[model samples]
Target: MEEIWFAINDIPMDVLSRLPVKTLLGLKCVSKDWHRLISERSFIRHQLKRAEPVSGFFFQERFQWCDDDIKAISYIPVKMEGSEVQHSVFNFLPESVVLSAVSNGLICCRSCFPSPQPVIYVCNPLNKEWVTFPWSTPDKRSSLGLAFDPFKDPIDKSTDFKVVTIHQTASDMEVEDEDKDSYLTFDIYSSKTRTWHRSREMCHCHHSLFKNKGIFVGGALYWLTDGDQILMFDVQNELSWLVTVPIPLVQFDSIPEMCIGESEGKLHYVLISEGGLHVWVLEDYLDFTWELKYSISLDEMEKENTEFLCNIQQRVESRMAVDTTPWMDPLAFKDSLLFMRVAARIYLFNFETRKLEELCTLSMLGPNSIISPIVLPYSMSLIPLG
Candidate 1:
């Protein structure tokens, strides 16, 4: 009976669809014929459709300089049964390298430089495969953001990813201007084409917030703009569109800057307040209706230093000090784990249990380190590909 099943060239589509992704992947090694059948794009897409999503944490190690010599350390989270495991350390990158983003198991790093023109490298730290993405123009100043399409169609599987760069262009005036109109030019680097294409469309705002605002949702990148609108850049279509967000009838000072994140397969925006944080869910992206859901008060932070928590610079610098720091950021995750970044520590707020636990503290070198740490929407704990 088993031989009869193996003898068939065309297996039932329904059976193939129902097989677990891991089982389907394992069957590829049974034989050459089986390998070819299981490796088909159609089969892979079906498997992805039924596959479950897992979360992983993305961690970075900081090094201190002693006698003009830099020494580094690594850290990892140990998931034990009950006790909070101390995170393990790993290998360190070059002295001047800074992590920009992590997507689909790839860690994107850029060589830190005084100027924006720098070398960008992406690597699968687990697999040890690294790829270098060169800049389009050597002298141009640009800021890069990396992302991958989770819902990408398997039929068009390509390892090539997307990099959005905001470049500084030559203006009509003599001196540089901070105004939005003077600062123009946006370019996209496609790994598949191995080239850069200039985008003529103007960005809706001058705020640098959108540089890291691109959040992955349904295989597309979503961002919030300074023009009081939500923008999405479709990877498949290579086009951008704006989505309206319902703004409350509050005073200008009452409206705080909004941040984008994902939760439970839906897109969410977090409104940071002096007193606490309020989370709003977008039921329909097209309709632009926002419903208030969870509201966390500052009084529940467990810490008394309200002034220090509000200072962004001080909060970042503190997180850079030690390996086991407590901090929190409004990051998107499948589970209701509110990862908050306090001074130098990260705390996990479990919505289901209504509890807050110290996750880990980030370690930094001497107080003179020049790099500013960046937080992406996704975490390494939520995505194990790192």
Candidate 2:
């Protein structure tokens, strides 16, 4: 009976869909026929649905004050209990590689020094499998982002994953005084082809000017422009569209910076002020209508006198306060975990329960170290840790 099953030319699709992805991959090693069946795009996708789901967040810590000049990588299991938070270090990153973005169990890094030619590296920290792609242009300072779409065209019968690079021309010090026609261009890199292609025209007003930052959602990338308009770059079709985001009642000139993040699987925009944090939910991406969801201010917190505060006061008295404005970058974590950094400390604000929790304090590891954490599975996965 086993020999007869092994010799069969075809297997039932229904049966194949029921097996786990690892089991299917193991069976592919049995024979060339099994390999063809398991590797087929359709069968691989079916098996993927049966695979174990990965945890939500992989928290990493970097010591910017350390003299060794090395950054460490680590993982934080998702939905960890308050007492289970661990500080496990993974490995040291080589001097040439700098961490760029994290997505779908993959962490993307790039070379440190600027060159006419650049190469981007993608690695799975869990598996340690790395792939490097050549980025030929050097005059353009580029930002890298990772995106995954199950519905995109299958590559070799497998779902497609993309690495997008937003390329902008280097600014010229001399041209700032004379040239007004300076503009930036964008290009995208595909993992399937291992090549770069010019993206279709994006919103000229937004993409060309403020193209440095964007948020990934539903296989498309979104960015904010000078006028508070949201611009989207569709990964599948390589086209661009504009979305309207509702503005607050505050004066336009008072809003200093605009950043995009994901919460509860929906796109949200964060507005920062010396007063506190304001979060707006996007009801419709196409129309850009936003509803004010949450707001937190530091005025209510009790203040304590500290050496750092005294130092800041000294600087302010000396007319050096221009360099010390209090600003923060807000991040949305899974389970409605909203985080923001305040002078080496991390604050977590819960949206569902309307509670504020200070997670941990961060100390400077060095002058160059940076921390960026993003929420995962933005759709149907925004719950607080149990």
Candidate 3:
């Protein structure tokens, strides 16, 4: 039976690469040659080229009560065709987890709370696999970012990634007049060498809070600086630069409801203001050019927005008043949809249809629990972190 099946199932490499990672792993046990074929490095590269499309989003949800805490991580698909669905939770992550960053398919997490020392972890939410890196020394409060581009380095074909901790750049520093030349330093951990290295000092107001606003594209990570410019980091070279920010509309709020995300391999800047939302795409990184995409009026969105706010208000205790501000945050950018997050609900806005649908909700959290949610665009991969 094995011989007959092998003869009939000699599939092409492209076809084999398109199979889900779970299926590919299972098929490895079918036969010896099958196992060898799947294990080849060249084969894995092809698999990444034809990687399974992103099916949904992975989020870190915190459910906190007066005395108890539950850190739940879950994945929610963009579409809901079933009767009712819930998030796929993974219990491997540590309690009181803070999801720092996500790139490619790996999620960067850190354990927070109570302890003076915190440990960082990288995980693939798809396969529910995780790797904990060594923290050579105890760390104070710092922001971290992850960078991964398997095909970035032309000289080396091997897949690797790095975790960057902007440990030295503090938002508020009391620099004495005599020490103005001293700057903040960066610490990086390379997966290739499986070690950490402290690099050169950066002379800028890093305001590492930019860490939360990071978006990776074309071998680099870009973060919004305090509205005046953008902080760009070259992950491979471990260097940083500043680029002037393109303010799409002058009427944009002081701190507009905005987000930076990538779509179709290009960086897009979006902000909501004066009942209108607009988008700007970074045309050329070197030239620092930006082209406007669209400025949409909220006239069509009022109904959907109202419904969404009402939905959440109905669930929350009447005593817990909802924010009366008319606003929604752009969480992510996809081909056909925009992820708009408000309160504890995430809604998918269809660009073509101009309609809003609740993508996912943090309902399982206790009635008394204070919820904090972080939703990120996720695409699962088969790459090994070892």
Candidate 4:
């Protein structure tokens, strides 16, 4: 028995790191040395680098009254095959907390009840470990963004994370249009020192920032704003800038549907207008240059998926059984595939083949239930949050 254990430990780390987290967890019982090797931060990093990160979607349902509010969150695996390992990833969190931001498998959640000072939590659902801290803010409606990178700082023994909050000091009625962009205050929290730093530096956002959670990509946090603009904050340099949206292809009087997402380690902007659907990629990050990647008209889409459309119409009519208005929303992007919502069904549009396939159908809650606009991207990891 002793000789067999020694032979197993002799396996090269490069080969051992390729094993799945579940297999590695079982291997830890082989010996103390094996447990130590699996628990080491360097070994964990190597395993993450060699493995494919499992991605999924988080759907949040909220109902609000004057003071009483109710919220529920559900996890949906994006893979076509029903090979999901975990069904309830966020059941570990206590009640009354809503997910704020998701980055690299770590989620930032805050208290949903109205409060001047709210308790913020950073958690890893994979291992069921979490850390909490209180944030002092007068505004209950302020926006919070989480930035976490596993390989951000090489010197640090563990992964370091940061949380940023943006809020305006004055009410919208008191602030004029010219001064609206100047009154925003930024509160930054660092995990290394476990402290919050306030910055009053001006970030020129002519429009109000969207209520949706910010997207983190390439060392920066991005938030969409009204009037076709994006607000960006650099976590490393502590600077803020604006990125302009590309002009719409069609001259539509109403506002078009727009969303920002991350794919292949780059930022992408998607727009759905009366003319059709257009996708853009940030080709040059420094110069803020955008290159249109895919453009498909509604006519072309209807022509391509006529049979699928007929089937979806029949499903919705039979299952929904309500006079609800249909909607199409872009949820997230990954590896050149677009995840979108049509009515109550989720779909994946392949950019290479120009084909669309149904992923899953969301359960209809009730006649009055409406799907929330926020669909967060999730990646599974075994990284600990301290």
lDDT for each of the candidates? 0.51, 0.51, 0.62, 0.70
Model 2 — TM-score against the truth? 0.63
Whole-structure CA lDDT of model 4: 0.70
> Which lDDT tens digits does candidate 1 get at residues 1-386?
67686566556545765675446557667778767756555554555455343233443333333212122322223232353422222243433455555554456666654435566676655434567767676432345556665455233454557776655444554655665354434577777777878776554444333423456666556665555667765555566656665664143333244456667656777654443566777787667778877776655543544433465433333443224332344443334555454556555556556566555554432242222223443333111122
- Each candidate's clash count: 38, 12, 0, 0
Name model 4 segments beyond 4 Å from true: 1-12, 19-37, 51-54, 64-69, 83-88, 115-117, 169-172, 175-182, 248-250, 310-326, 364-371
Superposed model 2: Cα runs more than 4 Å off: 1-96, 114-117, 138-140, 151-159, 170-179, 202-214, 224-230, 241-245, 248-258, 274-276, 296-323, 331-335, 364-386
**Pairs in clash, predicted candidate 4:** none
Model 4: lDDT of residue 50: 55
Residue range 1-386, candidate 3, lDDT tens digits: 75466457646566788887667889889888877877676677677766455566656544433422235555667666673334444565655566677777778877754445667788776556678876655454456778877666321355567888765444445754543443445688887799998877474653334413457777777776444566667777777776665764344433345667777777877765544567778888777888877667655456556776543322222212223322355766655467766666667776667778886554643332123345567776666554
Residue 200 in model 2: shift from native, Å? Answer: 4.0
Which one wins on lDDT?
4
Name the 10 consecutive residues with the lowest summed lDDT in model 4.
313-322
The RMSD (Cα, Å) of candidate 3 is 5.8
- Badly placed stretches (over 4 Å) of model 1 are 1-55, 59-96, 114-117, 138-141, 155-157, 168-184, 210-213, 223-231, 236-258, 284-287, 299-335, 362-372, 377-386
Q: How close is candidate 3 to the true structure, as a TM-score?
A: 0.76
Q: What is the lDDT, from 0 to 100, of the residue 226 in candidate 1? A: 55
Tens-digit lDDT track for model 4 on 1-386?
75676456645577778987767878889889888888777778888775444466766655433453335666666666865323356677664567788887788888777644568889988778788887867345677889987766531377689999888554466667676534456888998899998875657555777635578888988887766667888877888877877774234543456677877777888876655678888876667899998898766776798855543323322323213333655666655667777777777777678888876666532222344444677777668766
Residue 327, candidate 2: alpha-carbon lDDT = 42
